[model samples]
Target: MFFSKLVMAALAATVLAEKTPVTPLLLANFERYAAFASAAYSSDCANPPFNSTVVRYINDVPTDTQATLFRDDIAQQFIISFRGTSDIQDFVTDLDQVLVPCVAQGIQCPTCLCWQGYLIQYNAVANTVKSAIDAGLLQYPGYSLVVTGHSMGGALASLAAASLDGQGLPLIAYTYGQPRTGNQAYANLIDSAFNGTMYRLTHTNDGVPQIPAQSDGYRHHSREYWQSDDPPTIENTFQCQGQEPSDCNQSEPGYGIGNGGIGINAAHLSYFGISTGNPLDPNAAC
Candidate 1:
């Protein structure tokens, strides 16, 4: 009887913790960040409701990797977002998954090896993106610097965040439906660099987050924020503490079966009750 009572008390406490109401500011930040990620899918990069405006639009013909530099004056943020897989070349980048030594100006992790594809993609635009970020910060010296994206874009943004670190600017990254980005060493480097500011948002049953499988020596940086429920509300959002959490999204049905980005489903299409990562979505620009 005593053991059973103790178990019930523990369960009750856990339930109470989950029910903690989310602050409006926190929810709005996630929604605004999602809008930025979605905007990368479109050329407008405009969001009036969030008081954001496109500062620059990058379309590198050679690499065909697009990025948007936008600012949310209300949030005091200068954000750079990457576009997800859209062309045949992007798929080629995704499949070229060889792990190579990470190259980032601010990172000095000698043993870190990241996905060759992502590194190459970041390299193509790294200088331009850095210049844009530097200009934005120079004008608005107090503003925070943010990097964000979804799907393939998210993968590149993760690398950008690592490369932007230790630059004397306040840097944070938010990635949605991002794939495994690097080997364990690279993951450790990112995990340590961002600390509390990195928000890796994964949704329920989103198979895209499962591959470049662990067997392939790919690993994700911590800490991940998983929305376990369908609508991905504050109540269901939990910060997964480890590099990989078995009881979180990784434990979802057949998630392990995802290979070569094959298990990608509708969950990857949208985030936070809105459709994101779609290039043609008419509302994505808002």
Candidate 2:
């Protein structure tokens, strides 16, 4: 009985040691991203059918950071997209003049066509993230920074992650339904630079990530990809039908899919509270 009681005490201690406290810096980062979403959704460039849809999409997706009290303390930081300000004619002219040629002759050039527009938008978001970091809004020095997005947002997150990595920052990025941004060499470089920080999530039937340049060297992370058949729950179903959602089934014990792994539940929108199984130890620096 003493031995069993001791084992139980040890387990309790382990659990207590693992609990993470929510920090103000983390809360600031969440608010910063929220502002980014609000601004992106409100942008005039977020036009027509997409504008409304994007707004709702941003609103519906959850963040792990919101569960903490820090949510109320951070100052709001709003970002205005250049695309939102540019008239359609000017936007097209800029795209034709600046972005199109970047991917024109590449191996993934054909597939990159659609991403051209998204790249421009991502640059804006990256700038926003950088600005926040620079201003000391997000002050954690050792925390792992992850940039993520779903569908087009995933592409944007990829670019943002790459941009941050280039600046000699330590960060990781996981994109869902992300298109191929560049050639294999480029993708390889991104993977290496980010220390394999890039993880792509896909739903089996979701066609967005299948665009050109995606299949070459891109590595996917998910439980369904390797495990036996598990029926999708209403909570876990991908919005797009017929696609197998690449939720992070392989995440370590602390980071559960519902908590922090990638899937429809783990997409850029829902990352804040996804348990990640590895709950942050409150005693540790936030």
Please provide, for model 2 over 1-286, each residue's C-alpha lDDT reduced to its tens digit, 9 standing for 90 to 100.
Answer: 9999999999876644432222454333433333332233222323321122121112111110101111111222212111111134323522321224223211232322324565545443444456555443354343344455444455555656556666766654544444445444445455456543455543333333444323333332221111111232233322221112323222233332222323222222222222111113111112
For 114-192, candidate 1 gives per-residue lDDT tens digits of 8888788888888889999899889998998889998888989988888888555568889989999888998888877
- Full-model lDDT, candidate 1: 0.79
Q: What's the TM-score of every candidate structure?
A: 0.88, 0.41
In candidate 1, which residue ranges exceed 4 Å CA deviation? Answer: 1-24, 46-49, 257-261, 279-283
Question: Residue 53 of model 2: what lDDT?
Answer: 18
Model 2 alpha-carbon drift over 4 Å, by segment? 1-114, 213-286
Q: What lDDT score belongs to each candidate, Candidate 1 first?
A: 0.79, 0.35
